[model samples]
Target: MSIEVGSKLQGKVTGITNFGAFVELPGGSTGLVHISEVADNYVKDINEFLTVGDEVEVKVLNVESDGKIGLSIRKAKEAPPQEREQRRPQKRSPRNQGNNRREQLSFEDKMNRFLKDSEERLASLKRNTESKRGGRNTKRG
Candidate 1:
């Protein structure tokens, strides 16, 4: 059967490499499931996830013009809506909120805030260093 993009197919793992796993699809076509596509989480080693002779369901990501097939095992498995929602980051605290606050601010406002914070930090650092210097400014014998 011809492989089509977005189609899920059951294939057997033919070979495992550091970068990816080669699966032998139907009609004898082989495809590479990259390490990054092996799972939703980080995969340090492909062997930890897949092995030769293991049957896995993979979604066809792309079929290159040169006959290379790109597949994803993670995408093939659909997660429940609730489970998917659980994986999403929750509302962040004001201090931990990353770029959301900065993105809403105007360029001038952001620059001013940055400058104020920087000046404060610099002043604090200077005070710390000056205090560490033993009797630098004191009347010495």
Candidate 2:
């Protein structure tokens, strides 16, 4: 059978290589499915996904001028996207959670916290600036 772009067909894998696999289509025509096109996930090794004589469905991506056919297994049998669970759980802000929000801090406490943060930021900025300009102890005589 003649192969054309956008045609899907089942073919036997004739050979497997590091970069791709050669599939023999019906009527003895062979095409290559690149390693990256083998699956949706990262494929470090193509052998893990395909082997010689394994029949796989492939979509014809292109028909080159020199009779080379580029195929994609991932696109041929496109799997429905699986719902992925969130890796990181939603975090609750400490200030909005529990007793911290229930207890009202006095103005003095808020001012103290703000002052401490300001002092730390200023100290960090000074240290960063000083280090950039030949460091704290580098007063040249």
Candidate 3:
């Protein structure tokens, strides 16, 4: 009846909280399954997954010398199909992938485009900057 690290056990959930669920092990001690350990997905609420008196299979993650036990319900279950999806890399944006349309432009073409953009931005800045500071006071004293 000893609860060892890395062991799997069946337990009845005795209580539920925003942070986690408390389960009473067959060996007569209770442990917590933290919200993060309850599932592989983003669990915004632990109550959605477990309830008081619900039986769960949990893997013993650790047993501290001070007697605090760490458990994981997700670890005891087989690899879920969604696990593969999460493991696969997400689709990257085309901009990040180095397939930028600008890359197709020749060096001279790029320089020309840059010069044109710079001129336009500088012209806009010059027009707006003076207005933001206000025109000189032309009123006669």
Error of 2 at 8 (Å): 0.5
Model 3 misplaced stretches (Cα beyond 4 Å): 80-141
Candidate ranking under TM-score, highest first, comes to 1, 3, 2
TM-score of each: 0.59, 0.56, 0.56
Which is superior by TM-score, 1 or 3? 1
lDDT of 3 by residue, 94-126 (tens): 766786666888999999999999999998987
Q: What's model 2's lDDT at 123?
A: 94
Please give the lDDT score at residue 132 for candidate 2.
76
**How many clashes in each structure?**
0, 0, 0
Leading candidate by lDDT: 1
Model 2: CA > 4 A from native: 79-141
* Model 3 clash tally, residue pairs: 0
Candidates in order have lDDT scores of 0.92, 0.89, 0.88
**Which of the numbered candidates is closest to the native, going by highest TM-score?**
1
Candidate 2, lDDT over the whole model: 0.89
For candidate 1, write residues 1-141 as lDDT tens digits: 889999999999999999999999999999999999999999998898898999999999999999999999999997878998999889877776776766899989989999999999998988778767753664455
